[model samples]
Target: MGNKILVVDDEENIVKLVSYNLEQEGYEIITANEGKEALAKIEQENPDLMILDLMLPKVDGFDICRKVRKDGNTNNLPIIILSAKEEEIDKILGLELGADDYVTKPFSPRELIARVKAVLRRVDYTADEEKQEVLKTGAVELDLKKHQVRINDKEINLTPKEFELLSILIKHPGQVFSRDNLLGEIWDYNYHGDTRTVDVHVRRLRKKISEYSEQKHIITVRGVGYKFKED
Candidate 1:
């Protein structure tokens, strides 16, 4: 009917609940009860987005997200982690592993749908913005057309979330974007209550790109937010 979403959860109730709600929203749903099956379905169905659970059998959701992000074929697929863990570290790990959004278990169906819509909207927005071929700042260069990043002439792997976060900062050097603002612009969801998601992605982006560039351009402004240092 609409976007195809892969729901991967070991619990039959969770899968049925999510699939039922998403189906009602006009989304085509594919269900998987284990991590390995989810990966296979991802390859076979090429779903537009994935709703993953952390405590999955055989492969686990974290490993699945990591593998998906590492693969060139499905690296850009949008992911939303649906887990029971509410720990900050768990959320951070999920985001760092390339999940676009994280929803705790006992989640509201309406809110999950909202997050799905936000992520897909951002995906469409970025695709349209890719018309601006190249973006460069200091030693870092981003080719939106190619969906690639090069630092000091050496290409480095970046998850889609990381690339989008860096691209936003590099495009507007020295501008401090508040966590709320950044969450809105980058995630396409105004997660004012949980700004830590932005911080996690920034941390991952800094660590990965720091190997090539001498300067870590992701500057955190204590209570304000973050910005890219002007080259």
Candidate 2:
């Protein structure tokens, strides 16, 4: 079997359909029909990825996403939200809470599988890369191996996505990156036309880092994209 995947949906048919398709691809599948069960399975199975549905009994997908990201044990776990809600706010909320990707209901199984593969590929690539011990710029310091970031010697917590975004910009100062470019680099997939994801993340990243440093590290290029401050 390949990587283990957890499928959490209240609909039995949806669960069966997804499990069948994933199993055919040689992945081990663990399933839960409700939010609470999903959380439990995550701890016991330690799946490489999770397909989470928003509407579920007891706990909800948003809360689960928050919890998973907050917990040190599963903070780095990859989550893909599978929901029927088409509201832009819902999508933004899920992403803000730390979901790696979002898929609406009535989705193509092939596309979903492709997203799964892309996400796993990014994860493997990050893990396999040879990185310097630490990256330093101004007051910001990033420990690549430890996955820790500190500003002026004071550590701040950042989600995996935020950390990756900062790492990319700080590595290449003065290079402007369009929203599309950032979406491709950080998300590791074409996010259709949702550039707002990049904006939301940048806003949050700025807010977090701003608390510690007076100088702005990430700069908006007005109509363009963004760039890191150079010396």
Error of 1 at 4 (Å): 1.4
| Candidate 1 worst ten-residue window by lDDT | 186-195
Regions of model 2 farther than 4 Å from truth: none
What TM-score does candidate 1 get on C-alpha atoms? 0.94
- Candidate with best lDDT: 1
TM-score of every prediction relative to native:
0.94, 0.92
Q: Per-residue alpha-carbon lDDT of model 1 for 45-91, expressed as tens digits?
A: 99999999999989999999989989988988999999999898898
Q: Can you write out model 2's per-residue Cα lDDT over 1-231, one digit (the tens) per residue?
A: 899999999999999999999899999999999989999999999999999999999999999998998888897888889899879999899888888788999888888888898888877766655575688888999888777899989988777678888888988999999999998898776566488988888888898899999898999999999999965
Pairs in steric clash, model 2: none
Q: Model 1 segments beyond 4 Å from truth?
A: none
The models' CA-based lDDT, in order, is 0.88, 0.87
Candidate 1 lDDT score at position 68: 97
Residue 204 CA displacement from its true place in model 1, Å: 0.4
